[model samples]
Target chain A: MSQEPAVIDVPFEPHGLPPSVAGAAATTVSVSVTDLRNLRYDWVASAIPGRLLDAPLPIHSSFYETYHETPIKAANDVPRTIADALRGQLAAQGYRIGPDHADIRIGVIRFHEDIPSAQTMNNCFYNLIPETVSVVAIAAALVEVVDASDRPVFVKYYHAAHKVTPWCSPGQPIWAPSLLSLYRTNLIAAMRDMVGQIIGDSHFQEALAKGGRP
Target chain B: MKGAVIALAACALLTACGSIRFAVPYPSVGTPARTPGAANEIVNVVAKDDRTDPGGAVGRNGWQTLVPSNDPAGALAGGMRAELAARGYTVAPGHAQATLDLVSFAVDFLPNDLPLQASPGAPGGTVIATVGIIVIVRDPVARPVFAHYLQVHAAKPYYFNTSNAPDARTVLSEAMQSAITGMIADPAFQQAARRAQ
Candidate 1:
């Protein structure tokens, strides 16, 4: 007998506060931003940002790639695009952008959460649910940086050049701001001190010690 | 998903029950070549190097014994063979009309799998504090392909005998086999290859 899709409603309630800086004493740290690609997923075409179906690696692709010998500019451009986006968002929020003049540094980092399988995808689309099966959830974390000062400046950046759609055009887009709005919610959650602690502090050290980032 | 699983389980049960049968996904059979009107000769896959077999995945170390693809020829080449063969491609000894060369192979190791909750709350079952694996796959010849890395888990709460042989053997064979099967089944790869000269 075949089973029905379990419809396991994933709980994604708004977790915490959005990222923001309080004030002076160098409260901003424009961060290097990049995305964690979940290509291991089953229907990756839908999981990934459509704009980067053909973008280069490292900068816009996966950590499997590096900027060392790869000629493609998109390799390392991902971090730059992220830094620029965060700087712009911070500036718009009343924080100043500077090479080293900023206080309270903000770091935006994305890590892949899980992978999908073609079997699961086909099942989902066709309404087929297995009795018991495992599926990897496709996800990424967007971190917001805060200054160490008492004012506690909140530096924010909400776009990944890859998801900027048209702007994620690899080496072509040096600075793309297309993500300021769409990822605002996701980034805000990542920037929270409480949750960010998960990424900042040694919250999951046991796992980390067991394996390098997967 | 239920139907597929039920079908697969049924098939497995049938095998377990003594039905002596070999099957491949039907939708994937003879999907046709991409070259439009090319000679349609079988693509050749050559080993630029020597490939190793873990003697069927039973070894001294669970990680080491699992289908050894640590090297390019072993993992990368074997995967290409398996994936392609799964899709009904004949791997020739030498050059046919087209060829697969090991441009580059990369492996990623993840020490552990985090974001874990207490055992009772999640499905991971074990308190496996350390989890990681080596992803072995080939870089796309001309274009960037999706990740084909294999994930191997270690030191988890779940143990069925805890012998490296079964798990390592299962994973290694599955990874290599799937890689080749995937290559054959991918419509996108076929499209790109057809578009290429």
Candidate 2:
């Protein structure tokens, strides 16, 4: 029962409507990346390595099981990846970046890759079996469009997903040098895909077209 | 070789598991004494879960963990309704003035390995399970007044054998129940519900 209450607040600067939208549709919109949040939690990052040997293994086996030692690199660098993707997509859509009295502010609310142990070969007895691990990545962004009075015209939530199955067999080394690189590649691809989905949302476009206070 | 095959088959069978049934810990629980004249008001309840498996998860140790019943969202909503009824509120199916949405639920377990030889302050084989919930409440006008995301976690240490360890499903369910109780017991939520009524 240690849960706290929810309190959400956002500070916005006053800026006039975008040049594009006058009557119904706004011709141009300015945007700024307010924040990028990484929500993935990893337990191994703080664990003391090599100390596990002093303790009895969960399951008794002579052959040691290989765990994915390297923390998910893509999860660690999500802010950079999201920032880059957002900048690229906005620039292409003629949205100016920086503090030039933006009409919209974008923020990443959720970004994470979850690979549960039961879904992986880590459950195998001494890595003697093969299993397909399903990695789930979910990304969501919050977009708020404001008028010159700093009043919110419209607010929208955009979400995207990526799922992939990677196989782990008896002979395959879990801590192989290339494993981290592979995970990084997959995570980055998923994040970029979600960014595309968000920026291309029809509702998001309509919000831009009907640029007025809600 | 024969024993190995049997073990492998056992492991596989355990992996391809079944659901865990969780019973309501307390039945006919009375409503909050403070929130009077609240029984006549009707409130709609909606629940949903976005997990890989809603029946709960099979742990790496082949133990079925965090199962909130065959249908968690429905069970949770039902549990809430029962609680509300005890608290003097009318829970209805549709067109109520207020709505409660159990939007998201996630359960995760952390494995712990510790030294077999007991020493001072030596951590034993402990497994920690954490449950998180996101709940939203909207007024009659459909404006959100309360939205909170909270996590409840439990941990138990195992000695030489894990057989004596607590069941993960039971632990997780208890944690979840406590969390739900915390939300409803909040004075702010009580005031809001009364005002809506």
Candidate 3:
């Protein structure tokens, strides 16, 4: 007799403007300069282990074992990769990157990649077993901004996930190139989406304008 | 032989019923490399259990319910305190510039349909774990400078057993680690710590 999982409502939405800042007047001032700092990146991979269940016919099955292995790797420095892309995007928007005393400051609250994988081991038989592997890449980023006066501006979070098709069927090697390529591709897409959102938001544009001609 | 086969099947079925209790060991928070110019400001850490049932079921399927052997809130707070200390912050009680609240911790299980296989064996399913926390930073005058809610989730699949206690514990621990990691990695959290009185 399994019970229903408890339903607990979170006190607040995952992403939203706090009531105190939601109604603040949009800044009419415009500044063309800004600085980006405090970008951090965390890479988290699934810890689910592979299990081998021996269910033989004509005999009583009583064997079950689990094995752990690292099936994923981070091939590149994601933080630097995203930072470079962001700099180029901001430059195209007519915003100059200043070294110091900028009117506006941009910070990344969260930038992490979660690589979760699942395995399917062909059931039963005797020897010569077959298996299939599936993996998914999920990435999330949270960005925040502050005006020159150090007043809190706004915070926004973005996330995306994509499934990586296994390269070899009968038995795919853990470190297949296809796995890494697709994983990186999806993470980059998430970063692009974050940039697009920041530039497209009217509120963010207004905050940039408040920088007042650096 | 027939009797043996029936007994094996019966054993498997019996194993899947009733309530399963397991303890979630305190997660290990490794020593974080102190960032250059990182503040060592004092931070007050508080924890609360906001779940409707502290001793209630954390996970379940059609056959078994998973319950924790220890307090979820206490486990979360212990992890957070260790992580903050490793990040070069002084974690203590009393008036401080920053306060971290470990609000709620919960876990849920969603079992996938049995895969079409040649024979009957252990089935597979998934478990989703979530952790929520609030970070607040105040100025000398006690004016709130930064406040926000962060929720982190981790979902993983399990095989060889649908109601695997170790799998549930692992996912829950992963979610808890992410919550603390996410908070410390946030630029706003860093700024607030630096600005704390």
lDDT of 2 by residue, A49-165 (tens): 211211222322211122323233222344445666555565556554443233666665555445444223444424544444555555555556655556445555555556666
DockQ of each: 0.05, 0.16, 0.06
Q: Which consecutive 10 residues in model 3 chain B have the weakest lDDT in total?
A: B111-120
After superposition, candidate 1 runs with Cα above 4 Å error: A1-36, A39-214, B1-73, B82-162
lDDT of 1 by residue, B25-57 (tens): 111123334333323424444444311111221
Worst 10 residues of 2 chain B by lDDT: B112-121
lDDT per residue as tens, model 3, A139-170: 34444455566565544443444444443354
Give the clash count for model 1.
Answer: 25
**In candidate 3, how many Å is residue A148 off?**
16
Off by over 4 Å in 3: A1-214, B1-12, B95-104, B115-121, B139-142, B160-163
Q: For model 1, what is the error of residue A182's alpha carbon versus the real structure, in angstroms, after optimal superposition?
A: 32
lDDT of 3 by residue, B5-81 (tens): 33235335646655788897686797777744455576666665644346766655334567888987777778877
Question: What are the runs in model 2 whose C-alpha is more than 4 Å off?
Answer: A1-70, A73-110, A116-127, A140-161, A193-214, B1-33, B36-41, B52-69, B93-124, B139-146, B158-166, B185-197
Estimated TM-score for each candidate: 0.27, 0.61, 0.44
Instruction: Please identify which of the two predictions, 1 or 2, would achieve the higher DockQ against the true structure.
Output: 2
DockQ winner, 2 or 3: 2
Q: Where's the lowest-lDDT run of ten residues in candidate 2 chain A?
A: A44-53
lDDT per residue as tens, model 2, B1-197: 22234335543543433344443232124445635756666766676654434454423332333344456556666676777777777777432433333323443333343121323234334554444444555566544444444445555554322222234455546655766677677776666565554
